[model samples]
Target chain A: MTASRKPVPKPTPDTQPFWDGTAAGELRVQRCAACSRHCFYPRPSCPACGSGELEWITASGRATLYSYVINHRPAPGFEDDGPYAIAVVELEEGVRMMTNIVGVEITPENLELDMPLQVVFEKRGDMHLPLFEPTGAGL
Target chain B: MKDAVVIAGAAESDELGKLPHLSTLQLQLGSARNAMADAGLTKDDIDGVACVGSPIQIAHSLGITPAWLDGTGVGGSSFLFHVRHATAAIRAGLCHTVLITHGESGRSRVGAARMAMGPDSVLGQFELPYGVLGPTTTFTIPALRYMKETGLTHEQLAEVAVAQRRWANLNPRAAMRDLITVDDVFASRMVAYPFHLLECCLVTDGGGALIVTSEDRARALGTAKPLVHVLGTGESADAPIISQMEDFTSSKGFRLSSAAAFAEAGISHDDVDHVMIYDAFAHVPIYGLEDMGFLKRGEAGAFIAEGHTSPGGRLPLNTNGGGLSYTHTGMYGMFAIQEAVRQLRGEAAAQVPGAEISVVLGNGGMFASAATLVLAGHRG
Candidate 1:
């Protein structure tokens, strides 16, 4: 594990594929073979139907900004990322995830609700963390 | 609608503020002893022991080898669930008397253990790596979205801190009791966007405990204080991680738990005279008020800003100053329940006149779980 400001995730048997997909610059989610609903944070069984027949599917890498905050206080591993926008994005696949909003200045004026966003990957030793940036500046 | 279970006694570990000398276990033992004494019972009489942390350790240290033990760790709301479980356990003859305890050295870090999210856990892998810190960082996401959607202003959020301080001023036990204004709240340092320093809960070291028993057993003891009956209780859980919350603008856990509790209690909003909503942050109460049906959606911010939740308001909420101004030792549900008991007993520092019914709500882990209890002064 490289010494990063944030803690690195150690992939488990159930979540390895999700992490592997991120490293390959693709957002991966589990789809219940029975329910056909997408699930983020990969699990062995489908959350909606509780079926063991699960399949990994690539996400569109597009999302809508649901909610966010500009954290003024620095998190231990994210001291440099302080005053950054921590956001919850609703993926096009209907799943939501937490990520940082980058490629724009961290300010209230720059961040807007329901804004279009696209996923971008950053390399952190042995892992590629997914983050989001506005599709077009303030669009 | 007779209450089957009653709260025999309730007490906190020590003073509200910092106490560097006491360890977490010491705090637990102190409050447990105080609760037992308040209930007019000895350790030998407690057949059940339940807590959020280390029931066996608390039981051993207190020399109580309970026939029933529950160490359900669901966050601050764990204690409320403990009471709910204790109620059923007592009625079913699983135990005669149940004692629940909570203690945390949040400020002093005395006897505090470092908790690590398992690297393989969803939180450790997906959320933690993104620098989504503790509740303070995670909670801001929903609060910001709530403001955008609900049109709640920063001043309105500030009003939550101002109103709670008014209640705290009347209580000597409150941690920050010097009257604060909406302006003061805005002037205070910002922890996260839309959250002023004062808008957040005070990090104090403290613990609270509750003693519960069957209605018959409570009557038999005949303590001077009126028995606080457990009329109804509820518990629910959502995704543990903040990012995966079912809804960003509202809490499904809060809605489900309070609804179940109110339904079981068979009471409408009018019957509630007093309330205690866990205020780990200023936004929490707003969420509680709206989701619990005391007010409609997007109405709590204005309701609180208009002084509805204050002392002179129609509904007396967080009479103990809440986690925002009172003591918050990480998990704040126990203290909320303590205040509800006080109101029902008519012994609270800022007592609500003729307060016969009290509703106490507790939230755990960034809206991950919620528990509500409808307590009454009498059997009905």
Candidate 2:
């Protein structure tokens, strides 16, 4: 049986490079040259310094679990997956993004706050989606 | 505009909760008409309108051409922002009278527009792809972090719902009126980890509107309806993304907005008699009390668990049961204001006795924006 389709990220012109980097197995985020700080969920100008002079940098792909929820009801495309972890992880560079935590059991005992996690890409539809896995992530 | 602007009229839709018969526009118009009637005025008196929906459409249907209009759809708190903006406009001679309305077919989705954005939108790109559905998952993200940092027990979080339910039991209009215990909260379905079904808010269909006009105009009406003054108002926005909120334990928007309003009104925590903090989830009021400076950081959970905010508590809060037991349309700020107006008018089903000063704190997006209103029954 064919698997139920899930949501896939459609990259815009501004975010096409980030998607391209993900497909090539590198996590990318924008760093502002003006303020020397990083930004995520790519946009035109820097959020901190309002500088359009931003450059894409390959991130370390290392993040710590900042916060998350175990969603009981899955999104439309995620019918196959049971209750899953929807996480907000703070990157080593100090920007945060919403992604799913995979590669471990979805239990309170298994997922701990501030636990170390590393990014991994999972292909869905025609795009690669970034997800996280626990490095030593247990309470 | 302290004591210069007053809510001359305030009301909810003719009937709230599961009104498949009423479309969103119908709900909005019905409430607006009721508010004008309560004010002893008509559409001809309204020269300004504000709402999350199309103000032009509402103005045209109401048969009044507004001199000023605002379609600020920041979030639930957008109505609070409207009151603030209307106060400024009246003081600036932009408009003398304003009507602010809210209606959401949240449960039935009657005439409610479905919003869809392409992959380029911030949320579509960062949040949607991760199998996140809606507020149940997104707004629930910060609780774990808050608990971790402040050591707020899961029971304290559950107690927020229980306390609100106590108020709901007193109000005839509240949707969920059955008295519930913290264990009942724990036993209710787990919509998300660290959040039980009871800890979440009720999803009901409703609408509310307010009529704001100059104090002179309100007095000239000669109607005995008590005037609820717009003493001080403040609006502010913070994180666009929930994950980006500066702090997990408190809302920056709430802090700034309420602080500004209180400073403008020249009052301290001792002066407030009632409060209606928008409670989309149980944890929100816990965040609201602390962030608004009613209590120190990390003190709200215990304060609530101690019965300080329940019926007859020292500081009564959410007397209309709040969004938890009260009606929660998709955007809940309008109802919060409506309750404050009711308490000020001595008309609330669960009225706080001698509630002269009512503070309504509104939350917009997923902790992204906030607007605060300090309302007084009489000039201080």
Candidate 3:
């Protein structure tokens, strides 16, 4: 059977910068200067203090696996990626990002709270999406 | 401000469960007609139609061409928000009667390709890349966080599932009336950590409708005995993405909306005789109760365990099985309102006795938005 192609996300103007940074092998997030709070999924204004003064800054791309779940059933395009670990990674900058955990098979026995991970870009049709692989796995 | 009332009627399509016979459209039309008949009116009386997911198309299918149409699709709470909007429109003399409806074959074989684009479709670009995915997983994170913070064990959450199931058994129209226990809840497959299959809501093919009209018009028609007054309504939005919330343990939108609603109703939490909280998932009511000021932070688990929310308790919640056991036709807030009205009218099959003041809380969009309505029984 032919493997279904993976699904590609289309970025909008509000989120283009974040996707662009990922393609360049850099993690970017909006930090509000007024409230000094880091935000993700870029918006027009700061959610914390409702400040329009925000700027994109490069992140360290280091995060800890806050929580995750293993999806055994894959979607149409994600058949080969079955049993993948979908995790919520809390970046060192205090911003949490949702991404897949790669480089290791996911099992309840293997998964631990606060596992350190680093971002790795996966190129998909002119877009390099940011995904995290466990550090020291030599990905 | 305006004396807006649920004057006309309400009805559910089929009893909750697997409905292979009807499509979403069929369910919508069936419930819409029932509501009109119950109101002693016809489709021509519906000048405004508000709904979620393809309201215009559904209206056209139902042969309804409204002068004012609001297709504000805010998930489960869409119906309550529609009530608030419809109330304003009716007060402004825009439309005489408005029909708010919802239906979904949640268990249907319709693939994601045919699914309508949601407000969060943009999040798929960045958030879905990491697999945040559907409402179940997204809601699970906060539920887990709530568990961690409140010392609520997995069993306490199960109590909600067990209680709602018990209520469903009394409800003839409930989808899943199988007697469930805390063990059943915990042993059920884990859709996400801290959320078992039993703890989640049913995916049934059903539809519900509510007819909103002016107080004067309602007294004129005089079909029903007791008039259920729409005391107040409030709505607020949170972060569209669950990850962006300031705290997962609490929802500010719920808190704000409830405060506004309570203030407008000229009542406090203590005055509420019954509450019909949307229970899409077990934790939703936990968070909702806390946000609605029924319990202190981290106290919902203990409050629920104490049987405060069960039948004959201090607060009779989800008296009609709730979305957890009753029909969860995608958006469930309308059903909550229907139950509230039934309780106030003393016509509920499992009616909370002497329920004069009832509060209905509607949650939509993964704890993203909330709408609260306070309904009081008419005192002659």
Candidate 4:
């Protein structure tokens, strides 16, 4: 890794609870009370219905790889790593998110679209980043 | 408002590829001056200004002030939105003549604004912490999913570069002119998975500017430069982050923006004589071709690989080499607009014969926004 520090996510007043869930070993997303729909990357208003009434809920942590690119050029804190996979995964609740794929060799042969995966948190600076890995027993 | 606004002046910076000596402000002023000169006008003639950055600074630098100003900086496609906005402003009598300028030292990093995002911002909180780089990584994320669902092979993806190179070879100002095959593209350095270095756009230092005025004003001035009529314009936005996009296989912004432009132009797909889809990456045009209603899904791959968009083809595309082979200084929409005007005026280096109408499609911020323009040589 480069001597430069990695960027850390500073939670906002709206997103602090979501970050709190991650620190407690849970993946949390918002469910719009008005529309009864789930949303990721937690926000104040529902995208589907535009309602301000939202509730936090612990997610199943199950997802499938929707798409990704194996970046040959690593950002800071990934300099030591040769090439890494940055992915977007579709959750069981139908919302999609951006995350790093861990626990597998970064290659097209190893990573296929729609492959089963589960979220796992990794400590980065002061934040717990939710990274994904191939599904295994008890995941 | 059909043919009510005409492009009286358009020009790129004095030089495009690399200018380490030039600052961002210099690039902007240089191109702005060249465009005004091309229109046979002085600083006094320009009563309005528009650009991605502050219009006041540009106006003050040129010793001119105006009643109209637009600072719609929505990534590389901002210039297309400016063209569309200027058309509306001119027809509404809010501005007589509008000048849009774009300048960036992308490669040189000379006096360019630093890339910054708040830690609590949507992208900063969710995407950036995961080691997501700039466009090279994020913009390319959707290709694998698109390929899998549509059966678009890797070789076919490389064909996008090969086709544009053919057009680049015919233009002297193009940065990359040599003919390249699919094999050559694969042999090129890999920047991101499913995206070779050849498939990504160039990061060069350059700028471009445009001058839009009413048709009556052009007639009154009787300028010698050819006038390219603004037949239609449209603009729209989608999810800010790439992962939050409505659909992975297509772009909502592209579909909506292009449809509005076509509707306003009152022309069928058959009327378009030439095309320029902003190719920030090779897959972008594929998304554009299908989203813009030119072809059905799962068919654009074959259409491009078959040489339909190449030089001498029925629907010639990116005749000025595009951002891929030509100069792409950060915001590339201005360059795309410049090419359409050139083609319509029959003044392009790789001129298209009998071309009366041309369409330009632009994408901004990883499909986050889009704008489309339909232009013609004469009043239609």
Write down the lDDT of every candidate, Cα atoms only: 0.88, 0.90, 0.78, 0.90
lDDT of 2 at B27: 88
DockQ leader: 4
True contacts kept of each: 0.87, 0.86, 0.26, 0.92
User: lDDT tens digits, residues B269-316, model 2?
Assistant: 999999999999999998999989999888899999999999989989
Q: What are the clashing pairs of model 4?
A: none
Kindly provide the TM-score obtained by chain B of candidate 2 when compared with the true chain B.
0.98
What tens digits encode model 4's per-residue C-alpha lDDT throughout A68-129?
Answer: 99999888788877799989999998899999899888898999899999999988767788
Worst 10 residues of 4 chain B by lDDT: B1-10
- Local accuracy of candidate 4 as per-residue lDDT tens digits, B252-319: 99999999999988999999999999999999989998998999998888889999999888888888
Ranking by DockQ: 4, 2, 1, 3
Ranking 3 against 4 by TM-score, winner: 4
DockQ of 2: 0.81
Give lDDT tens digits, candidate 1, residues B1-380. 44389999899986757989998888888999989888888898788999977899988999987999999888889999999999888877899889999888888989976766777788888777777668888866798888988999989989999999999999999988999888898899988887889989989898989999987887787654679999989999988888888877789999999999999999999999999998999999999999899998899999998988898899889988999998999989999999999889989999999999999988989899999999999866
Candidate 1 regions exceeding 4 Å error are A1-3, A137-139, B1-3
Question: In model 2, how large is the Cα lDDT of residue B207?
Answer: 93
